[model samples]
Target: MSTTTDTAPTAVAAPPVPPRGGVTIDEWHPEDEAFWESVGRPVARRNLIWSIFSEHLGFSVWLLWSVSAAMLPRIGFDFTVSQLFVLVAIPNLVGSLIRLPYTFAVPRFGGRNWTVISASLLLVPTLLFAWAVQTPGTPYWAFCLIAATAGLGGGNFASSMANINFFYPLRKKGTALGLNAAGGNIGVAFIQFFLPIIVGGAGVFGLVQAKDELNLERAGYLYAGLAIVGAFAAWLFMNNLSGAKSSPREQLAVVRYHHTWVMSFLYIGTFGSFIGYSAAMPLLIKINFWNQPVPEVPGIGINFAYYAFLGALVGSIARPFGGWLADKYGGARVTFWTFVAMIVGTLAVIVTLRQLTPVPPSEVPADPSTFVYSEATRAAVEANSTIFPWFLAAFLFVFAATGIGNGSTYRMIPLILQRQAEHTTTPETRRADMARATKESSAVIGIAGAVGAIGGFLIPLTFGSPWVTDPVEAVKMAFGVFAGFYVVCLATTWFFYTRRVTVAGRAPALATADV
Candidate 1:
């Protein structure tokens, strides 16, 4: 009895508290197994779901111009082909420029708060689009400015990615981030697929009847309503983590790492190609395939709207697969192979392009209002029609490769930064170094995203090629250039990550590091 009275009491763990709505979490510990199982999982999942929704809508708005530009001629805008291409490229350019600021915005304003604000800002672009389309005699310059506002949607990608990076532990981040990105990337396909039906341009697989004329403003209004819903959803359902604080200077420190710049360049090949092709595919189909006479089929041509969404859909679906493969085989290996595939796909596209003949300027009507196909133009169209399927197949292959590359390259970023951190840390400082690595990786994601998006702008401009007399010739040249670029990307991936390398008598290759 005297020995029993001297025994110490057992300690019990406290019950987990349920996550509160619209509040900052003061103490977050995703890496702690007990904490993650009891509380972190549900909270992180809720944030990820809403983040994906808002970002998905943002992508829809950003790419509204891509589909809209193809329809403008139908409504009597009478703009040149180059001018229409400019409309599509403007949003991409603006979107790329704003991504850096958008990335920093997550830490400054808090994820939940910034998401609401960013979602609300989408109203500016949607409403402007509605006004521009409905208003008679809108100037080209005015349309350019209106299109620039759509870039607001592009910025949402960087911020959403950066914010979600803070919510997951390293083991699960790849899958979580892949789903988030895939959701947003699919927005391009969603708008391209649905806007035609929504605006009464074409029926869904001929299920619905198309309007005699397009009501383009209807698309703007529908997306505007969704943006409002996205904002409200974030305000009601999302939470912010208090521990996810960092100054711009702290985040910007990632720029000092050589890997950051290298990753950004590689990203230009993957994400850049994905987005650039998404923006241009509709128009590319329109210019090359639509209005062309099919062989043995009188008075019938390909409908660009019917097939334009496929490229984006295939790419979006392949993105998650890319991430999975990277997880199993390593990112550098996946990325190098993806670049090789892209190069092959691009060359195949050029081969398809070479088999067709385009209508000369003399055969094309100066005013679309008075357009009619000449016999020679009809023959050219008929010849081109036979090769359209081949062209589409080649482009789709490239899209799939880009999607895979996008996922692999993103997965590589976190592993690379973590390895770098391990190289410099002692056992006593391991925890602190890991935490810093997470922050740096998140920052690098934003930087690479911003840089990669510039390709979206450049690709469309290259295709448009206002200075060139022959648009088809310009396209062929562009494909050749793209193939060459992918080869360079392949070499870069091999040299820096895939091959064994010695740095000051230490093995520093990412391949050897198991990243």
Candidate 2:
């Protein structure tokens, strides 16, 4: 009864691998018929590392405007405050629109192909930014056009997350994703804080007419060179991870679960606030406290972007803590507290704004709070004295809440999915479905991440334009309004998940099957 007892020697297949770093062996098989992984896992992880780095560079380029716009006036570019906001907001607007479709790019094109193409696209805007600043003749149209190309960087986060999700286990996803996301988010702070010092002055990207003013043409070339370095690094080190599946129905079907929608909205609070406020910070410092002595003992005052990055740094630091907190307590519980804190933070800013000049700003007053003639700012007349600490406190609170939200939202996804799996299937089937959900949750996470990042762009534009007495008032009013959205998000969570009568506790059958 022996099947095919022909004694032909069977050659055992060897594992495949990337070119051995120090050891060289040709004809490697990663997915060998016998050992389908050993070789493959190492290669997959290497690719993931590179992919995250390249995407990180993309984000740095995308939000470069947030830092650079504050420099325009200092660089002798003829831009008004409104014009400055418009310019800063250009990339934000374009980047947000691109994120919706970018999540699907992976399934359509291999992640490898798109990564290469998208990474390459960043060069366009970087080069253009260098060019625009060089020539004063550069009309607003040209600036807007160049900024539009920066959106390419923003879209990379979506596709990259979608691609990476296909490569790992479910339990490890939060760590993996948090790393990838945090890497990208840090870029805003990194560039903002460093650029002023590196550039040697605030507007050094442009001509050096005054200590503060710079020529655009010179700055353009410099920034372009830096972007080129980033592009080259991406191309040389990054690997495209392919052969993954995350169709809209496959990935976004999570939306069918009302909880997914709730999470998405809450993300607008946590993530949206992070993104919006990060971009606005630079402008806020310049408008509000320009008259304050530059903190640099010998150097230029704190650059707008530099000040803004503090908020981001705090936000980044808080993310892991948020995740850890969610792990210990339920996401719903953590999120409820985040709501309370953010509301308090927003109110602080509003109170700060209301207190600015209890007497009219125009009245002949020696009030130290006012930014009047005797103390004209290095840049311009400062908007208010107390605005600084108030804004700072507000930013700190927002970042803390957002960090909590990041952890809570991420924590909720798997629990929700796992709970659903447990309820919907037979014991045997439930185990299998739960395993499947563990994997699918990764994809859902990737899609949600990309979707959540769009808030970065949206939050800026939303609060960027509103209540624009100046950038300072604009931010305060905007955050106050933004806080209301967070409140609504809190109510939604309460209405759905935390509610005793919710499908979660009430009709357990529907919770598992539907979500």
| lDDT (10s digit) by residue, model 1, range 260-289 | 999999999999999998999888887776
lDDT of each: 0.87, 0.62
Superposed Cα deviation of residue 426, candidate 2 (Å): 6.1
Q: Which stretches of candidate 2 lie over 4 Å from their true place?
A: 1-45, 202-243, 246-257, 291-306, 355-387, 414-454, 462-473, 503-515
How many pairs collide in each candidate, listed in order?
0, 17
TM-score against truth, every candidate:
0.93, 0.76
Off by over 4 Å in 1: 1-15, 203-209, 292-300, 360-372, 502-506, 509-513
